[model samples]
Target: MSRYAEYRALAQSLGVDAVALVPGPNFVRLMKQDFHSHERPLLLVIPAAGPVAAIVPNLELSSFAKLGFEGEVFDWMDQSGYAGAFAALARHIPLGSLAVEGQVMRVFVHHALATAFPGLKIVDAEREISGLRLRKTAEEVAALEGAIRISELALAEVLDDVRIGMTETQIEGHLIQAMFRHGASELAFGPIVAAGENSALPHAHARDVPVQPGDALLFDWGARHGGFCADITRTVFVGHASDEAQAVYETVLQANLKGHEVTRAGITAHDVDDAVTGVLEASVFADRIRTKTGHGLGREVHEAPYIMRGNRQLLEPGMVFTNEPGLYCIGGFGVRIEDDMLVTQDGCRSLTTFPKGLRILG
Candidate 1:
């Protein structure tokens, strides 16, 4: 059955008239169309029964039609405001309680929708919609694998030329070029090229600072392929590393490995996180830990079934998540080892394989 049909069934079960989707990863997945966001509002209405309806700007009518949209389209030109289109949509779909992506829809659009149907009851369906995409199909797993392959290939190519004195931005540029050469549809997220003291920040931005020997060069990056994403992180030394740096690297590596080791079909998401944290807490660098153990990965870089403390969500087969553990010290350096893994019937399999062992580059 089509995703829309599935969603319609879900809406019916929930006593909702229809489910609305805004332009984003979920919308792209449902429509299978690649289009940019526009100033004009566009709403896709999938009702419990009958054809779908869309309110698209006149300029984008042709592009939207590429989906061969079988539903009624209420297109409005730039000269006319979208009020009429919204009214027309309400006339067809009727304004009752409707499900919407609370996370992706803009406030202006929500207000416009409320104006269209004064009695319209908006239900936040973020969890319901996200649940639809929580598990990966065979095709999705293969696509994720392809993305990881491209990322690993890119890292290997870029690391060959990495040397001391090169700026983080330069390294980022090389990584980008290599990903494209290796056939990445796009980057999953901005490449993180944190070095030395900068690595202490979990989401540090690439700086113009020159890489120096003894610095922990942490790279957290991913590639997009077929709309699926692969996130992986590996920390390496710029040159000869200090004894302290190597020890931190080993501690994080062990935690990462333990995270994967404890991930099985019957375990809770918290179990995986606790296992990793337990490993780190036993080490001397326990207080230096940063960020959660991992998060779900797929169409969007981060999704549902987040693997962290306090989450008791069961680990099911076909579910994919990252197992990243890190130790960061201010004014010193940081070490993080991340890998994407797939939960199977028995245990979990690591999808990202960019060697977690500390490598001394330059």
Candidate 2:
């Protein structure tokens, strides 16, 4: 929100003058401040929309005015759809080949571009906008940090409800209640309350099966505050961890540690993934490292600079991401450790810290 200047600078880099941003100040706040609500008006607000010029949205949203957008505030009122509305909008776009968001913009309004403005060239601004959001501002980092703290508190309160003979549905309800009590705006994603062999699935949802003493419970969850989210997963043993469980958890822990160690400014996200793969390859159960090492985290739970095989994007200060490495064995069990990280100047800081070593839960 405080980055109008930054957006303008990006516009200058892209060689465009006068960006056409969709109006609705309140909606912008919702996108910036609420999870699952980040998609609205997404296509029209690319930071690189124009050079030293921002098309002020028609709808007034004073909340973001605090960020200082003292430039040209223009709009097409709902009533002026045909008069000074659309035509007025066409007049302000000064660039011959202006950039526009095509991905997240509503399909209904898309016709306005191709049919109404036959000469204007709207470039794909999604990547530029997403890239800008990949790096967290200080205020944005603080918001995520607060969200993480609340998530940790909620997880701690919900652990007691996990017991032998307890159904995954029952446990999920308790967890949701705890998250609400701690002020989570939403669940980062649906609570993953898998037990026993069900733990093998990485994205399992809470099911109706009753837990047994020997079940391996995997709690992969997150908490949302305002618009930011924190995802963390911790696998626990119902009675006593089996030998296979112990070995798999230790391997995952080693990979998570390596991922954390290599995560620093100037390093590419692929570096983290490669480091994790190295650990997994050296471990006895090497082939089971099922998913990409991790991904960048922020406004959207999953975004840019993904920690995968071929990514070359380097880490930078104020960039926030997740390091979630997992090992899954079919029909038996799985082990995972996930944490949010902030890339500082020299190294990165872990944002989710809810004890990742094996937990013996009864």
Looking at model 1, the pairs that clash are none
Q: Report the poorest 10 consecutive residues by lDDT, candidate 2.
A: 34-43
TM-score of 1: 0.96
Compared to the true structure, candidate 2 yields what TM-score?
0.83
Q: Of the candidates shown, which would achieve the greatest lDDT relative to the real structure? A: 1
lDDT by residue (98-172, candidate 1, tens digit) is 999888888888998999998899999987877788778999999999999999999999899898899999999
For all candidates in order, the CA lDDT equals 0.90, 0.71
What is the C-alpha lDDT profile of model 2 across 225-248, one tens digit per residue?
Answer: 867888888888888888888988
Every model: Cα RMSD to truth: 1.4, 4.1
